[model samples]
Target: MAMAITCMLRHAVTTSCYENPANGSTSYFKTLTPVYYPPNGDCSDFYVPISIDYEQPEFNPKFKWTDSFGLQSFMAALTARASAPVPEQAPFVNAKQFKGDYEIAASFCTPRKPNGNEKKVIVATHGIGPGRTHWNSPFKPEEFNFVQYALSKGYSVFFYDRLGCGASSKADGFELSLETAKAVLKTLVKSVKEGKYTGKIKAEKVALLSFSFGSFTTHKAISEEPDLADAIILTGFSNNITGINGNGLLRSFVPRIANIENSARFGDRDDGYLAWPSVFDLIMNYFKAPAFAPSTALFTQSAIETFTLSELLTFAAPANISAEKWDKPALHLTGELDYIVCDGQCKGIIETPAKEMYPNAKPLQVSIQPAASHHLNFATNATGAYGVITDFLDAN
Candidate 1:
């Protein structure tokens, strides 16, 4: 399976979706309800694919070009600086071996003055791309600063780069597979569950904070390995289509005449960079004759580059693991103006789904930070509405 995972990308078309066993919702698969085609693909003889079935001009802001230039430019600067030289320090503990070709690297910071026992431990993971260690830019350091903040509060912090990312080694090309990714997470949880390293650090319970695609991957981890984390937070949730799953069919098969009207009214921004994830959604929306426009390609690319297409499929698929199965308390947060992830999509998947199944379970608190972009909202000690998130996490 491990070897197969590394090669899955070689043949993976564009995007893939999962079939919901419990519900008939083939969330990933379906034809445009406004129109239909025959099974043999012969209905195309008379059917024209150019009619715009629905229109939402306002959605343009959410999916427009240049909308996220400010944020992305800042990130780029940070990454460039972080690439500079830095002193190396020994890891607090040894890296743990996981499933085939995977390893979990952890860095620990014990409380300066232990009152009685070790302070609480929070395990964190960075979103896609790069390694566990962030670049030396202000924003990247901001992440380190947050971890340091936890330390100040007498909390030990453990973070690692996901496979094919920071610090961790990967095979050539490093194809992304949910099962392979989950295996590494499961291994980390198992080590914690069995108290392998509990003796060194008195970690009472592990708290996990994941953002963007990290949330999706983390959710899968918690679902498959119950003992992985005691508390979980998923930030920036959404449902978007991918390029591999029939999204490309529209661009390739649609009639040139019909595409004329729609292309002029709604289409991708050729001048800018459209991340892989957003490209998939745009293609899907364009095919369905719906407005799949995003504010900018950079924002979508941020998401697409954050996690591999295979990982996105896991997030979009019907969660086989239900809230009822999640024993630990979970908290949800989304940025109000987070066009890439979108607040509505986050609530739909995390908050709404949890409410339906676990009637008696603790309510999943959802917080929306006004005017906050995806990264800024999760920041610690942030001024204005962002402070509210810090306060909530602290109070909890």
Candidate 2:
């Protein structure tokens, strides 16, 4: 109670309202403020400090593929990696109560012209490769930025860096699991609802827009809290609970130490923070060509962000598979060629599982954006995919 009250009383970040897209009436700013928590914001005491403890892989970053006798052999430890990992096959840690004055580096924005959707807010969670900028890309904003697109369409956005990334508070990477990530997200949702950290936007409707691991975090959140979202859109997602695609994702990511791969940008981060070794790794895992532009793929060399190994180790095969009480609308958008989740084809593989997971969600729709990969926003036809998402949000 004390922590929540303290955080509540703390002054919100000060910054100018968003005005760049001059015609629209919204505003913008970046700030780090305290993020308090509950295990489940609706069910638990919202004021309690939340601590999440879960099993984690003992997979040390220092150990090479060779150290495990080979990459193939190391795969055995995580052989059962899926939506709900087979316990024996997992490589991990083990234990939750909640405690923390965590902080998030967040950017809040609203639409300019008053429209039916201006009060609607999308809480976006980016995948491993980008930060909050994934939604508001500085690189060719018009063609690829979802944030600018949403604002232009008369909606609001609350985007932020996940803990241990960008300007957000950094923690021991090994201790940062998806459970903790989900709790952080839930806390942020509560604050966003109260207009606490987000420049007091006081959103009328809140939707969850998630990609890749962020999608996993969203799934975890809704599994227990049905009321967490009004609408949910998951891109770069699939119900890969079983050993899907021969474990192609982990092999491609090849988890390299961030500092070793790009010392300049990641040298300050700890060893647990990981980055893929090369553009090839990203291309293999996140991009599909000739569907995507070469320049865009090349641009990823700069856009790439480091993520934690613990997140990967803990994300798959969630214990709870259903969001029975969530009767809202859902859009499961993925690239037809999303190699990571769909294993290069989305139609048959991704649809049914997503449907099964959100069985109670009314008007649940699964869309496979043609010619794109896991990085849907970076695709050549990204705007097309973005349209599908925004349209769903508007209608639902």
Candidate 3:
């Protein structure tokens, strides 16, 4: 019966965004700002001072898949050599609470013309190996940028780099635990709600849009503070690990320092990061072809970001959270071919698990994008995923 219900939802609204284009009335500027916040409140009391880089844009950058023959060649050579055996990761080290000041990078986009009403803002958090760019593709923006699409629908979007990723403050790999992440997100939400961050546009309510590991952080945040967001969208996620193709996923990552000389794109990044040596491994484990352009794969490899050891250990830590306290609307969407989260098939099996996880959510919807993998936004059918998200937000 559960499988039957999931199948029905899958078939009812599986159209790609390309087939059904989005329409909107406003255009706005993409402005960058720095937001500084002090540690306070229960969630933030553990915080150090932090500066966040923010972006406000009316549209995404024009899509362009510029060739990087040299980078491509280097990647090919790295992939050819056998991957080194992954070393036993160091044990988790919890950062002392209230460790002074740090900085984070973030971006925001709003419609050009205000609708004369309280606006709804979506705060997005990216997964490991990608920062804000994960939400808005640098290459092929039109085809893969969810941020621009949300803007087209008159929705404001906020994206940020986690403490140890992208333009944010760098920390020892073990310093970025789940508890630290929850505090960071909680503080950001509070600042945004108070109009301290994006002052020009005060948000009536906020929604959370998270991908992969970001989804994990979101889960921890919302579980602790049930009213954190009016609505929540979880993508590239699942609570079940029994189905994951772990072996294939594990082999895809090489230590950042393992091939530091070849990774010119990362410059002098430290051991806290990991890199994907094989585009083939990425496609097989994270993306599905035909649904994702070849260039998307290459660009993903070239622009890969760091994934902290603290995050990995935190992810592996046991959790016994209950969603009975959550009462907001929630949605869980994943690619049908998500090898890591869903073992290449998310439909028919995700609904039950999601229900168990978000039991008290008013309307918890779970759907799978056909022909996509874990990285749905980069897939050819990304517009479909985007449409599903905006539609849910509109309905709620």
Candidate 4:
């Protein structure tokens, strides 16, 4: 019965132009390729290509006003006030008050051999996917890796799973919202500040590097708690700004009144990136229905099915705010051909604001990786180190 239902559903739906082009309309569809996440876990975290080789000391230029290549990595990009890595790192508390079995991890890296007194800290937060282990190859421990790259430079590195994603326990999907994500990260930072589990940290002086969904949570933290990080680096992400009414996917199925009521909690509207493509068809199939008709979970059965690229436009522009509200140094990195966060969107959300915020700050230095997709920007022909990321961080 389930197979019959599934086949019937598949037949009823027609793939967009990419899948099945119309008689005269040009097809804009691209192949949907699955990304391979290495089982040894070396390909998960946002990483850089290792092909470009440069000595460590030579890479960290000593002079302030020297002409240098654009951002090497998000960390090395900063030249603000001699931001060095923290002295040491000890195991801190996990994100919750659980009483069961859990794994705890920690490590230290020095950008330059510490001068014994100068202390700096850089903490990396993972996206809404696998954990640290999956990012670094267990077999080739010393090969090109993000953790190893940072640790070699002296930045105290810390990363862990977010609840059920990795070795951690699992739970409902909606619990993975921006709020819950922020709370978990805040808890980790708090543990470091208080020296609760393993001592050794300068809580006041902290930096943040987050990618994808992690970027949203980090931005919310900075917006809510000004003291969390001295500076923030947001790569491959943009704010989810939605203000339009009654035009999202959910309206096609559920009553507009019902959707309006649920809008406050379930994001701006239904038919987000999750419900896209499928939900788009739903809206077109039942375009003439009264405003009160319920939608078919038809194609967008899961929350993941609620989103489409079209909806992203509604949230690309920055929200209005005073200059004083954002005083800290921020670095925004994006590839020119990013299929997910379109270059245009990045310009509107980050590039333009960065120019206004830090006028003297170099032109929103962008790394235009030709023919690169969203994920490939961070994880590409490089190994061990995130050259682009570290370069962006060094650009201050």
Best by lDDT: 2
The digit string of per-residue lDDT tens for model 4 on 190-243 reads 665554322344544566776555655676666667677666766555432322
Kindly report which residue stretches of model 2 are placed more than 4 angstroms away from their true locations once superposed.
1-90, 96-99
**Candidate 4 lDDT trough over 10 residues, lowest sum:** 27-36
- List TM-scores for all candidates, in order: 0.51, 0.78, 0.74, 0.47
lDDT of 2 by residue, 1-396 (tens): 343344334421111111221122211211232222111111111122334344434445443343214433555556545654544443443343434565667767666564777668888998777777677654555677787788778787787888777667677765676877887888888877876644535688899999988988898788788788888898887775652454566667787667556665666667667777667777888888887777666555455667876677666656236766778998889898888776777777776777777888888989989889889998999999999998998777
Report the candidate with higher TM-score, 3 versus 4: 3
Give candidate 3 misplaced runs (Cα > 4 Å). Answer: 1-90, 93-100, 116-118, 245-248, 258-268, 316-320
Error of 3 at 191 (Å): 1.2
Q: Cα RMSD (Å) between model 2 and the true structure?
A: 10.1
- Residue-level lDDT of model 1, residues 30-124, one tens digit each, is 11110111111111111111111111112112222233453244223323333455432211122223234444444444455554334355566
Which of candidates 1 and 3 is the stronger one according to lDDT?
3
Of candidates 4 and 3, the better by lDDT: 3
Off by over 4 Å in 1: 1-99, 114-118, 134-144, 172-174, 193-199, 238-307, 318-321, 343-351, 357-360, 376-396
- C-alpha RMSD by candidate, in order: 22.4, 10.1, 13.6, 20.4
By how many angstroms RMSD does model 3 differ from the true structure? 13.6
